[model samples]
Target: MGPWQLSVSALAQPDKISHLPLRWIRGSRAVMAFTVSVFLSSILSVITAANPPYPPSTVIRKIVWAPVDTITRKAAGSDNLPVTWADDEAIYTTWGDGWGFEPRVPNKLSMGFARIVGAPGNFTGTNIRSPAEQLGGGRSGRKGWGIISVDGVLYLLMGHADRQGGQAQLAWSHDHARTWTFANWKFLQFGLMGFVNYGKDYKGARDNYIYSYSHDGPLADTPADRFILMRVPKNRITERGSWEFFERIDETGHAVWTSDSKRRGAVFYHTDGCLRSAMTYNAPLHRYLWWQQIPVPKGSADRGDTRFEGGFAVYDAPEPWGPWSTAFYTERWDVGPGEHGDFPAKWMSEDGREIYLVFSGNDSFSVRKATLVLAQKY
Candidate 1:
């Protein structure tokens, strides 16, 4: 946090400045060294990475690890799912294809479903028997969704992209993950701009509605879009009329909510994109934890390390419509670019000290899961 070294050997000397060490003069009398402090500060920022503590151990699970050169076998796989549900019985994940983009046909693809029984360490991994089954109409964009449970009901905030572009819709499941019944309704209209990629969905005991979010802009793993927010009343899942758009918070510190769906705005903006996002309420910290898998590209604008720009980052905020701040971040992850990283609610602790990170990528078989020790809250 102090006393960083700056090398000026490679820097060109300024013309007008007089001081030997460097020009400390004001106005246009500045030299090229004017930017030296700015460069060094950027270095210090990476040195002082605001990363949460790493987990004690990282556990890997394969929902369907099919070798690239398989004979008569098709590895069961579906790794990307913003909708992750967990319980004492089992941990359930849905959406995305574990098979990747193979077969190239896209004709027989189904929304992959999987289950990990027991708990994190003692989990049974995947049963691996007939790992995937068709969900919905199997339309290409029908699988993008954000799911949350209010009381005993589970709500799925599904998004789609057709020839006409993007849109968002809703559905509910009463029998856990065994079956899903889609609401004959539209949450966000066809031309509603963002909220097309609802990464994480949340419900608060102190609040009356369920909150949802999205990160859609430019491309995946780069600076593009911010975290967009939306919500619907708990009592009105069936009533599309109950959905409300989050405008912004007022000066007095109260959240401003309105029924006009077109009022949607990005509560938190980031360049990270192109995948599912995970969110949950951390009771001990009194904040929301947003876990997103952002692939730091080769020429990505570096916030810290140029070689490694984005990976899985933990962003914390006091409100759902976040005045959010970074709690922890990393430039390294096991999955490749455009991959997704997520934290299942059950694997996270109430104090925000420990977490299990899940990673899934393009056309791979296994889903990489790591149990990371979160940085102790300072």
Candidate 2:
């Protein structure tokens, strides 16, 4: 009887309130006041189910206007070009052949080459490519390409022809923009290889991965180079599936994967006699690769100019591999003085909020979407 006086004699029991009678002690004081009001409503529902309400924003609802046709002007007339966002919303551009095959298509058979499918919202300048029998034709051309949509399906990462004949080819797309199903014509044996880019992480329930690279050797006549990390399984986009290579570092002809608000992971490339331009992050100690000597300011890789110039510069990463930090510079509104240029940019929607900048301008090659808003703390 000393444990705090036996809890004050168990609340001063009068035979523990006797077998309560007297209208059962007024219905036991209304059943002990409804069990202390359901124990304070379950402690306020476990403190509002452990907090999370909303405070971090970037909104630009819709501005999709893609239609610069003539088979995207013979696939942007070839040279490190890229445009991706295909699930049926359409927009998948690619270009190469700066050297390999010489007939860069585009002589109007509806435009020698093709791969266009507009009609998502506002690309109504009209050119809508999509016809050459759903765009097919393979030689040892078509460089650095990577397009992903996984669950809704649409996967293409090219560099085809090899089977003792040469290397590169891993394509997939299931009847939406028409047809394409080549599971492997030579899925990465590295040779003049150039899928030079691709990155996706999705977060949370986890299951979204596609990191493709290679643009400087194995087939510019075998120099033996390396860079691979492909694990795209958000539901399946086949290549016999199952991949994991990670870490080979720069052969750089092109590679962009951004995100850096401290979630970590950054990579920007082009260092193989493209002269130079680099950035890397995935650090705890190592993985910090660097070589950005800065010197892209002469007509900013010109092509005509309608505003927004050149390309390469992406930032936003929590983990695709990084220790990055550079908020915005994907051609930062084509940077100062007379502004009207912005080139080959990508990172078109990933919580960092849409940024699909492309520019060769007026003569045609304009694809823009820069909607990123993040500034709030109170």
Candidate 3:
């Protein structure tokens, strides 16, 4: 087996010691104990060498949320909001299946781009109609899943070019999302990709790489068994060949990346499953926050109306490819957490305790205030 490969049974079957010749050691319990210890240690080394100690416990005890804030003019009648803070001191975001912001569009747009100005509570959005904007939803047009700004240019991750579960492409705007140039390449295998936000113009990023994540399946609405991660040098995001997929972790707990997509491994696993996520780095707390949507089960009443009501989960980690810990989770949130959500870095408090959550509830853009109760220091 390769160095990165591990047999599940090797760690699972710890009691299978029949292969050891106990007769040689005979009544010497000390020798027997040392022999077994060595055997177990070898197995543990192999396992740790192949994978990180995942699902690490969190420093956040829990998240306490206030009621969803009432919708203001700009946020109403839109959903699928993927946002990024630009260097120009404004938040740029995308909206789907609605006329965006005030003075609304001439007709409903499948996807539209807008720039938000002012603070979170008092901000206003102005639609920036672009020739690149898609006109319809679902099969007819594309869904905007992720957006990021680096060095004054804005990049958008477009999913569902053919279908929601089909393909994703990168489009960028040099003029603050006013005009875009689409990349010719398509992410053929990874259908839905969400960018990891690192504050204004990628300022607080841990490294030079821009990270992204996707669930196991192609469909964005459907739950997947695991989440996959990928990263590209911040300067080469549009170059298809520069992207690398996460494969595994070495014995040092450092991430191993590969250019080969097929060799990529899972970064996160959820028994209850997860969908597209909103991720941001909290510089004050030095943790990555992942706001993931939990899909309702098939054949259930909630499944048909998840847009209005369903489940949502929040997790935090020390890195983008996480040994994640749950910060908040609920099967039945008071209001539907929508299909998409984001915790814009600009809205976070200096101490990283108070924050605002932007999501689509009742099929409209919504905002809610939340407080983080951190684990007490020893």
Q: Per model, how many backbone clashes are there?
A: 15, 32, 0
The RMSD of every model to the true structure, in order and in angstroms, is 11.6, 23.1, 9.0
lDDT of 2 by residue, 1-378 (tens): 321122334333323322221121243353332232223223322333221111111121222333334212222333333444444454454433321112433432211222444432234322322332222223333433344444455555554344232465666556532455666446544543222223221112223555444433334222221222334344543644354444322223122323321221112222221211222221211122221112244444322121223333233333333222223333323331111112211233334344444433323344555454443420
By summed lDDT, which 10 consecutive residues of candidate 1 come out lowest? 53-62
User: What order do you get sorting by lDDT, best first?
Assistant: 3, 1, 2
Q: Return the lDDT, model 3, position 15.
A: 31
Q: TM-score of every model?
A: 0.61, 0.24, 0.83
- Which prediction has more favorable TM-score, 2 or 3? 3
Please provide, for model 3 over 1-378, each residue's C-alpha lDDT reduced to its tens digit, 9 standing for 90 to 100. 332233577554433332232222344442343334334434543454222112223478778888555443355678888888899989899998888888788888888999988776688889998988888666467879999988999999988766644678899999987789999988876666889998888898998999989886665556665788999998899899999999975545567899999999877776435567889998899989998887777666333235688777788877787656557767678877787888999889999998888887777667778889987860
Q: Which of candidates 1 and 2 is the stronger one according to TM-score?
A: 1
lDDT of 1 by residue, 235-297 (tens): 775787776666755544456777775676556544333234666665544656666555445
| Candidate 3, superposed: residue stretches over 4 Å from native | 1-57, 69-73, 300-305
Model 2 spans with C-alpha error above 4 angstroms: 1-157, 160-244, 247-316, 321-356, 359-364, 375-378
Lowest lDDT 10-mer window, candidate 3? 49-58
